[model samples]
Target: MSQEMGVGLLRRHRDFRLLWCGETAGKFGASVTAVAMPLIAVSTLHASTLEVGVLSASAWLPWLVIGLPVGAWVDRMRRRPVMLAAAAVSFLLFLVIPVAARTGHLNVGLLVVIALLTGTAAVFFQTAYSAYLPSILAPEDQPEGNAKLHGSASAAQIAGLGSAGLIGQVAGAVNAMFANAATFLFSLLCLASIRDREPRRERTTAHSKALLSEVGEGLRLVAGDPWLRTLTLFGAASNLALMGYQSIQVVFLVHTVDLAPGAVGGLIAAASTGGVVGALTTRRIAGRIGTARAMLLFELGLAIFALLIPATSAGAGLLLFATGGFCVSAGVVAGNVIKASFQQRYCPPELLGRLTASAAFLNYGTIPLGALLGGWLGTVFDLRTAMWITTAGVPVAALILVFSPIGRSRDLPTAPRPRNDPGYVHPHSEPSPRSH
Candidate 1:
């Protein structure tokens, strides 16, 4: 295990620190929007339960729509420019929301448009950012870098959630979006300050491969590799359930639990403190129990508490929601910490963008569907019953991870199986980078 150097990276690595600050700012902004956007739809636009689901779905729909091509594009070009352009687009989209709202022009349809456009930007930024990280840091420092990044993101989420409510209550949800817009500018400034440049992409004769063929190569890499396949499948299932509940959680807290709009943010912020706890403890727990086993403990074992969410009522009962949400956040973030380290070590650098996009396509593609499902269920049955159905699937989804090879081993495989083996090439072998 690496020594807990604490401030070593922050103090010594200039470029990493810039990237960390940028990412932290971006996440904080996004978390605030996560709460404020829903509040706008519910409170300002008078969006129905179903419309809110559609709004949530729209934000993630781009993953399904543009994911494959974006991955291939990220692999072929410089990542930083892609990230810069994406951040700029997100900044403009968010800036327009409050402007439109103040002008008496905001509506559910417009909100969906903003969500879709911003999400499209996210597709580019997230894919490029994932691929860009390794370029900024040496292989040995990546685990430490990832821990700090994830821990800071979790902390930012907590702060953002806490502040979103107070800001929404005092300033109104429309103006609160100004804060999200500001964070993007902060991110852009930080990104611009980074000193390290990516090595020029290596060129090769393999450039002749069709773009679709390149996309197919990435898909096959994940499909043919057992470790990647299991994790991808588990991610898809887990996200489906996670998004389902998330899409309607605001409705449950406000309408079902009868909480004030301002109180919603604070309670959620309190629950998200668990993400910070999870990120901090993941390395230690993995060191104690091994990474693969720790994954099960995090995903399958602790995730079971998600059922307690629907059981929440008022006053004392809200504690049930808080506790359940806290456990779920902790488990999910801890598992993510383990997974990020595993993927970075196991996969080839060139394929990281496509691997991230392909996996996210499976993982995040379901978000829209889950949002729609949760909304539909909430309308047909009731918010509380919908909550029950959706939250229950969270633990049940973990069974996918448990039954796969992840459950049988103490650690996930760090290398591909032998070439002649079933889980090995054609696609498992790393491909040379080519100018498209």
Candidate 2:
């Protein structure tokens, strides 16, 4: 293991090491599937843009629909089981693709169903992960741990996607899916290896209460807190902007930039490269600038660079969009590290899972809309005009945070909010809890 890694930083803790290794493998496998599934829809199934949109939406739409309820359920049970089961099911789901493709029965409807199932498994994995880490690490180390997870996942997306793209080209799409299936099997093995007794907090199927009330409670904390509220709102706004751009990316690259599909996919892979760099280096850079300033300024720069995309000539659009992607990726990585760290700090471990889920529901709920908007808007207008709309929406994020605390400060301890308290602790300041 790398000594400087977050898990390495906790090298003496055997259980955490096991969990870390498992999550790393799981994240990598998940990324591979995320990339491969889309290719299968486009190539083997001959799906149209509307069909592809449904396939894509199927992946994230569950997060909006069932994320909170699932979070509540996971919080009520042992998370390790949830994690292990998710890995197993994901493996089975991917395996179905190759089987269906071979049988000559693969269709858009079936692909959509598969995407939704895979997405459901992903929700479990993520919900367990969000709650699991805070319990394992001390408050101070949460940021480093989160930074590592984000960094590793971003690298995995680029690496895994790049590899899958190559496989799709070299072999057929059906054969490429085997890679994802293989990854899931490895992830399942890793997850099964974690032997630590799950540590539980105040457990509840909190959703059984009035769904509206539970939602309100989670929303209230975020809305009531100056910092948390700002981060949540900004995050939602950011997702709307970014997802909007991503949804239309293929069209923009194809229609406006005049690139072929393969070239467009490769450009996106290149753009995510910057995000990987940012994730790997978040801790060092944030430590030097303070988390607050780093997040605030980087996001502003991200918006500016996003605006520069539509202005490039068609001949150079690929390069310009690639450069813009670099900035957006960097900003998202850095911003997410700061924001998630801040959230994990002030949130109660008991509320962490459900709260995270509820917040995810709001932020990601807009994503489906963004994708729909991008596809429809791109189809209707000049692709360049759609890009302009996506880029311009970035300011809405800043606007949401303008009156909140995130724009002003950076790091905070990942402890739950004190009962009606007024201050926060930085995780690095009091990390002895993790050494327990």
Candidate 3:
């Protein structure tokens, strides 16, 4: 990589800048929807705990259903066009929510459908975007690019969370839904404006086989590799616990903790600031501590603090929530930075889409279950009891990493190890980046 590209990718690369802008805008919208959707269910529709969990589950259910196929599809086509289509689809889906609300037709059922459609769009866009990043920037520049994108995403999320609460307070939560629609439009424009286009990739004969076979190839690569398997499994467990707490957080804060809607948003925003700090510092921390050790530090050590969230209440007690949330968010984002860079560098470029999809399918697939578990626990035992169960599970999830090869290494391996190497295996010969 050129020195200019290495140090200032955002400033020097036009296409990357466009990609970053669109992704950041989209994340902002997602962050808004994250807060607004649950608030709408709780505040306007008067949804029950189980209903709230189902609502959250609807959004991620598509990942479990279509994630594998979508990965193969992304590998076959140009990624940008896929992302463009996904963005457009999400924009229309979100627009439907506010329109339905205005027409007095808004209901939990409609919200669930909208969530499913938009979530499907997210699966496509995110899968394609992950594969597309390495195409725009040199390999050496990727970590810097990832850092910038993640940092901005965190910052945007903070803004969006704070804005969602403010907007909900001022114009009602339905209007906040409209704002999320607007952010998708902003993402579309930025993405459409990008000049760097993907070169067309040839369809491999492997694609001619059954689609299931293609999907299996991707799944095998992840399942067969120790590094991928460990990280993916850990991600699954972590998300289960993370989403379990988050699925009912609004309900917990509102009914259990007795906070106002705006205060809830403010607290979430405050906690999310840790993501910004994590993204900014992940590279430096990884350099100092080894990447593998840093993963343990951020993901394992900080996760213990998640138990503090359920302990929160009025006044000084709220700080416990913020402090705990800050550590968890920072840890998660830091771990993601490490993971994203690792996946990009370590995996074969040809299978990037499928690799991402396979991992996400497993990682994100747990989300719906977690949401349901949280909602169920809240309904059956009480919200605080549910929080205790879920929050404590976060640290326990980290034990997977402690036992994996990551625990023994200073840094994660840069390349897949050849088969016959003790305890490590590379299932497929690494391929070069495709033209498209």
Candidate 4:
């Protein structure tokens, strides 16, 4: 990596800079709403825990339905406009919430619909952003770029959680949603400032595949890949455990731990600090430890952290929660970097968008199930007992990766070379002024 590229990434990489700023704002605001939304449903709308679970599922449900077709569509176009449109629509939707609430027209049904729309729009934005990232930097610089993205994401998670907690406490939940909406508006403005050119593809005249068939093709792509198949399974299992825990987390914090509502934000921030630290160090760690060892190390750490959750089942205070959060975040950051680097190499460029969406959809599809299970269990069993049931699955999920080649492989790409996949632009092809 060039010294100049490193220097420029701090604030240069104009497109990354703008995208980062906008996304960071969006992420932070979303974190606030993550807490506020459920809190509002429970407190103001008098929704049941199961209803909250359904709402949580509503947010992720779109991925299961529209994930693949959207990927195919996204692949055929420049991503920036798609990203901009998604953000704009989401911003508009969020602004409507405050107006409705103040007018006494806000209802539980409306909030669910809003959550669903926001999540659905987020799918397009996220997939496009992921696809666009690789073409932005040098091939050798990818690990560095990915690490920085993760770091920004972690930092945003922390800021969002903290801000949400503070706002939720001071302004009340309804007004707090408005504050998050304002952040989205600001994010749109930041996106507009980023001027990096997207890949120019001539509009294709090929007939589009049927929606379900496109979804099937995406699934077939993953199934064809040995590594991706394993990774997909691991991701699916991990979401099951994580979502299960998330389902009851709010109630646990409110009822069992006796911590104020703001404490969840503190816990999220506490764990996200580990993610920030891990993301900052990932490139160096990959260089030093090699990719395969890093994967195993992160997974083991994840399992240990998962196992330690039951220790907190006895109420080890906030320290236990923080420890769990830290390890979880660290493991996730390390694991994702490895997965992303591998995917960029393995998945064909023409199919990258769909394959990624397929994987995400399959993985996330389990979330609603887990959420429903958690809510029912938490409602029936005590908090500690419900937690035990949930935590048991974490080690199992982490260990599932042990059976995959990804956990045992260490190769990391240091160059962007063309293969059968010709749809991608090799950013390394053009000499950057910052090239070493």
Candidate 5:
């Protein structure tokens, strides 16, 4: 598709517009919760650094616990209903938080439970949503769709993060959760309004497979493919390092850097602007420098800025954190836009749900471990020392991409090599498709 065609998709496509709005709204709410949850634990309950880390871990733990099966299940059912249920569940769960705080019933344990349950809902919604997108847009339109959705998500996050601290300061941290709940409601309404319907999937008895068998197929698909394997590994390693530092960032800024709540929100919102830029420019960058080269530039080249995060201090030094964060955010978001488009085109539509879940299982599974590691490091040593260790791992993790076939390629492959092609090299000699 032409650039002009992609840019005009939102205007021409009504169902896609609804999907974009709902997804963007959902992202906005999640971003608000990201700031507000940690703030509540720190400011309202006086949570320790380790407690904050555990809280962060709780939110991602469900990915490890149920990711595979959920993917398999989602493929068997229509995606929209699953997303609707998940959104409803998330809305109610977020709604309960402020109520509990007001009723004097809020506690760390309750918070943990809420986080875990909401995370479960997120798993279903995300899995269903990933699969559902391909059904809405034609193959050529997917890149622009992914770019617009990711860009809008980043923009919504900026708005959410910018507002979170003001809400916290004015209405109290616990009550700020009301904003999150409201966003989910908006998302639900938008989703319910979509006019297009997904045709029901029909499975013959001979084609049916057990859940575990389906899960294994998904796992093997990712593991056996060179491109998917390489990208998945890079994502896993990168997230480990990313979440490790992020899990403790609030504590590092609040306690070590001595920033107030509102200042903290403003700084993070400033840093997140990079995501918006990255999303807006990714398609042009890939067009200019091949998609594979763009991935290397974004994932390996820009990630070097992570080292500056540890250099953050009180006043003038805070720019160090923002600059580093901006680069990392830009790189990660741009790379994701490329990757999302690649996957939509490359993978078989039948297995997209499984593919998403299987990849995410490995990618997000490391998050809890990273969070705990950050917490343990903070507890065992000091917060700054922990930050130094974790932030340093960011660029190092990209070395996986460097040693793999991605480093040598100009563009990622458009389709998987035929299974019967005996001449295929596991990580080399793959066919390159026309550049996006």
Candidate 6:
């Protein structure tokens, strides 16, 4: 790393700046769609509560379908091209929605299909992007880089969500999708402008292994490592509870809380400001208290406030919802910053892509199920009842971290244990050559 890239990376590291801008723009667009998609389903198509939940589920279903293979494939190829292709595909898919709506062809089914395709693109983009980050910055600079990127992403999401309702109301809800599509174009341009090049990965014998074999290696890596195992399992559980309530949030606010469409966006945007704060402060907090303690505080302690979400109503009660949302957002984003830095330093570089995919396969796989569960509970009982059930699960789920090995340590491990150590379980009888 050059001196120029040391402390003032944003001003000096041209490639990283480009990557940050592209990623931030991409996050902003996705946030816009998060609000716009459900709004379109409810406002324009007159979708039922169950149908809206299904629409949310459709976006994450691809992780279960293709997440594993995509991770292995990302390992075989350069990451940038995969990201580029995925972005292009997403841009075109989102663009189709407005056109379809204009032509009188938009329906719940079409909306579901678009969500699924864009979700597939997201799986590709996210898997590739995770593996690509460590290649750009030196290990020492990674924490700072991660903080800046995550903070900007949170900021962008705030901007996107804050504007979504205004755009939906001013321009028709269907047409607001144009803003989402345009962001991808901006991201594409930013990515294309980067001049740095990654060296070609030489095709060694390990690279020639069977796809399923490679996938299995990734899975075992997560399963065998106690640290990785704890985090990955907690992620899966946390997401299940988080997504469960989030999938039906819009409907709950609109019907049960009796809030207008515009208020929904404002409340969510306000709550999301906590993510920005968390991202910016995580490194400092971790340095002061140690990463392991920070994790407990962020995931378990702060998450207890989730119970407040179910108490929300039209006027004065809305603050309860925002307060709960803010705490949850802060906790999740802070936990992610710590986890990202840990994984980058702890895992072998050769296996990073597989590790990312395998972990995400478990982590994100539960999203669709959670969405379906939220929808079903709302349909079977009532939206408020569903909110209570799901919101309560948020803190309950964090108990996984408490009982696991993470709770006993003051700091997370800096590196994996040696294979010969009893604490270290190798994925295979003999280590693969690449692992050396």
lDDT of 2 by residue, 58-80 (tens): 77888888887876776676777
Q: Residues 58-131, candidate 6, lDDT per residue (tens digit)?
A: 99999999999988999888888888999999999999999999899999999999999999999999999999
Prediction-by-prediction clash tally: 0, 11, 1, 2, 0, 0
lDDT winner: 3
lDDT of each: 0.86, 0.70, 0.89, 0.73, 0.88, 0.87
Off by more than 4 A, model 3: 1-7, 204-206, 416-436
For residue 212, give model 6's deviation from the true position in Å.
Answer: 0.4
- lDDT per residue as tens, model 1, 1-436: 3444748878899989999999999999999988899999998888899999999999999999999888988898889988989988898999998889778898889999999999999999999998899887877787778888888999999899878887888888888789999999999989988888876665572355678988887888789887789889988889989989999998889899998878899888888888988888988888776677889999988899999999999999989888998999999989988888878877887788888989988988998999999999999999999999999999999998778777766676555344334375323122223211
Sequence-dependent TM-score of model 4:
0.89
Worst 10 residues of 4 by lDDT: 427-436
**Clashing pairs in model 3, backbone N/Cα/C closer than 3 A:** 199-436
Per-residue lDDT tens digits for candidate 5, residues 122-218, read 9999999999999999887888999999999999998888788778777887877899999898889988999898878787721489989999988
Per-model TM-score, in order, reads 0.95, 0.87, 0.95, 0.89, 0.95, 0.94
Error of 4 at 189 (Å): 1.7
Task: List clashing residue pairs in candidate 1.
Answer: none
Distance from true position, residue 112, model 6, in Å?
0.6
Q: Weakest 10 consecutive residues, lDDT, candidate 2? A: 427-436
Please report, as a residue range, the 10-residue window in candidate 3 with the lowest summed lDDT. 427-436
lDDT per residue (tens digit) for residues 54-73 in model 3: 99999999999999999999
RMSD of each: 5.4, 4.7, 4.9, 5.4, 2.4, 5.2
Which has the higher lDDT value, candidate number 4 or candidate number 5? Answer: 5
